[model samples]
Target: MTVPDYPRPPFKPQQQSFPGKTDKMDPRPDHGEDSYVGHGLLAGKKALITGGDSGIGAAVAIAFAREGADVAIVHLPTEEKDAQRILELVKKAGVDGVALACDISDPELAAKTVESVAERFGRIDVLVNNAAYQKYYESMEEITLEEWTKHFNTNVHAPFNLVRLALPHMQEGASVINTASVQSKKPSPNILPYAATKGAIANMTVGLAGLLAEKKIRVNAVLPGPIWTPFIPAGMAPEEVETFGEQTPFKRPGQPVELASAYVMLAADTSSYTSGALLTVSGGAATL
Candidate 1:
């Protein structure tokens, strides 16, 4: 079946009470299941992606696998089914795929996840620190201190732990790609904490790029506008979900596969000079 292009909302009103389980999605978000074609851009590479069971991480896993890379994804234990599906897709590409289950917010578990992957693969070529936690709040009173701290722990601290643990396994020519958001520049009132972490990720990408340049490791970020993923309907209201991407100039949200090429470029050898860059994959969402 041909997936329709953007500008039209293509899904029904469906929601998952919790994150993970891509199969529960209404339209079953397209992870280039039949469309994305690879060209050996990342051959012989080993990649570790947090939250790789679904959404953008799943899309990247499939793309990297097709391009000839062995993939190790970290996801919550509840996401085993979704991780199984991604593993199947990676295997189809004739590459190895391993899925590790753990809550990345735990610094010790996060470090161990990276170590396991590095041990299995011998080294890490790509590290995508994409796992995040988000919740909608109407007012400052509605947001608890624990909630705020949890967001930082999962969204910010987990990335830091993973990077530190993986750095020793990363050599020259390695790439670290972070998933930032259009919210990084333009904050959405409802999801303040999530947006704040995205801003931090973008800033860290630039600073880390310079820090890692001496080691010849590239650090970059992808600033996505609004993509049609479980994150949307799961986080927003039913009415908001119905009109999800209407605010964008494209009048629709981007698909997971649409952002695949940007990730591929950053992870590939061709983007060796593309460190510290913020590649916006927003469908006409304005970014400064």
Candidate 2:
């Protein structure tokens, strides 16, 4: 299919508080609501995604449902409206769908969320660790210890905890997909804390792939570059948001729907031989 002409910047200047609402975005992100079509790639599978309320996670949820997987998406309590909308789309694909409200930064909460999903689905064939925390800071002095820790907790530690908690439900042929970032290799000083966490996630993905190889499970990560999502407005300055993805050769940020197929390919049974891979989805940008 021909790629649709996705919106390009300079976007209308906008800003939002942490955990931005989808309805608030100017051109809005496309979570494959009308475009994505499936062909039973994951029929009868059960998958769980963190931060599935908006952005990449939501798109993956929609794609997974269309592909015939039962999906449970995790989101913060404050994102219920967005979560519900995604869940509605998921169910519309004629599969089981649920929205789990939990702050995965807390180990206990993360564990409970895993247990709840496992109980509801009976098994987890796919785990997508997509939730993340990021905020741009002009200098190191502007980043506090609390903010630094929050980044690790939400981005790194939470994925680690979820993997540990969800493994029991995952068996042979299961897949684990982490959302690493181009920032992992090409770090930006402004969001150093977030970049650092993504670096850790990329490393963790490789390590876990090795460790889980004996169990016949595949582990991988997707390093996305400058996607147009609620994350931009929420984590960036209004001025920065206006020109979000101009640095890329594409001259625009990607839409959330654009990353859907990467997640689907990683989770599908056909990719059984794929593991320890960091698939970069940046539009014409190079990463180490």
Candidate 3:
């Protein structure tokens, strides 16, 4: 199938309440519903992805399935619509896809989610920490302590919790991929708390890679720039959304499908020697 042209925006002004719905976007974000073609790179793998309900997580789930992995996705119950859509696409790859609804910010629940997936799959071959929470704020004061704490809980601590529980179930050749962001290097003042959490994620990826190296478990991260996803509509101001990816050298926001290849590469045997690496899919944005 021919890939659609990368959208150069003059995007229509839009906004959605937090945790946006994929179907509601004016020009729907593509999750390789028609473009990506896999090559059996991850065949027979058992994978788990957080935030697999939409955006990059959904794209990765679809790609991993196409590459022949049975996938289990963790998402909020409210996102059942999006999760169902992703699982349907995964099934097209002839692999089973299950969506587990639970708040991963709760460490206890996060641990249980990993255990449940491991129990179902027998073992986990790939762990993708792709879920995050972010909302724009005018100033530091605008970010309440509760909001700041929630940001760390969801973006930073959840990954730690899941990894701790999953480590025992992960054997040699297992891979853990965290979704870091360009914001980790280029901090955005308006989203200070979110950026801080991303910085922690990037650092955590490096530390975990070294700590887990003895067990031969590869740990890495993908740092994405501005990608066109429901996250933008739900998290940013309408004016910011209008020109979302314009600042990047590519003059366009990346599609979620664009990041799937990097993910597949990291999860596949090809990257066995690659760990503590940050694969940037930032559409030409510089990272520190």
The best candidate by TM-score is: 2
Provide the clashing-pair count of each candidate structure.
Answer: 0, 0, 0
Off by over 4 Å in 1: 1-3
Worst 10 residues of 2 by lDDT: 231-240
Per-residue alpha-carbon lDDT of candidate 3 for residues 1-288, written as tens digits (9 for 90 to 100): 565787788899999987898998868888898888888999999999999999999999999999999999899989998999899999989998899998998877787888899889999999999999999998777999999999999999999888888899999999999999999999988889999999999999999999999999999999999998999999998989988899989998999999999999999999999999988899898878
TM-score (C-alpha) between model 1 and the true structure: 0.96
The 0-to-1 C-alpha lDDT of every candidate, in the order given, reads 0.87, 0.95, 0.92
Candidate 1, residues 53-154, lDDT tens digits: the string is: 889998999999999999998999988988888889998999988999989999788878888999999999999988888777778888888988988998
TM-score of each: 0.96, 0.99, 0.98
Error of 3 at 172 (Å): 0.5
Q: Give the alpha carbon lDDT tens digit for every residue of 175-278 in model 2.
A: 99999999999998888999999999999999999999999999999999999988899888888899999999999999999999999999999999999999
Clashing pairs in 2: none
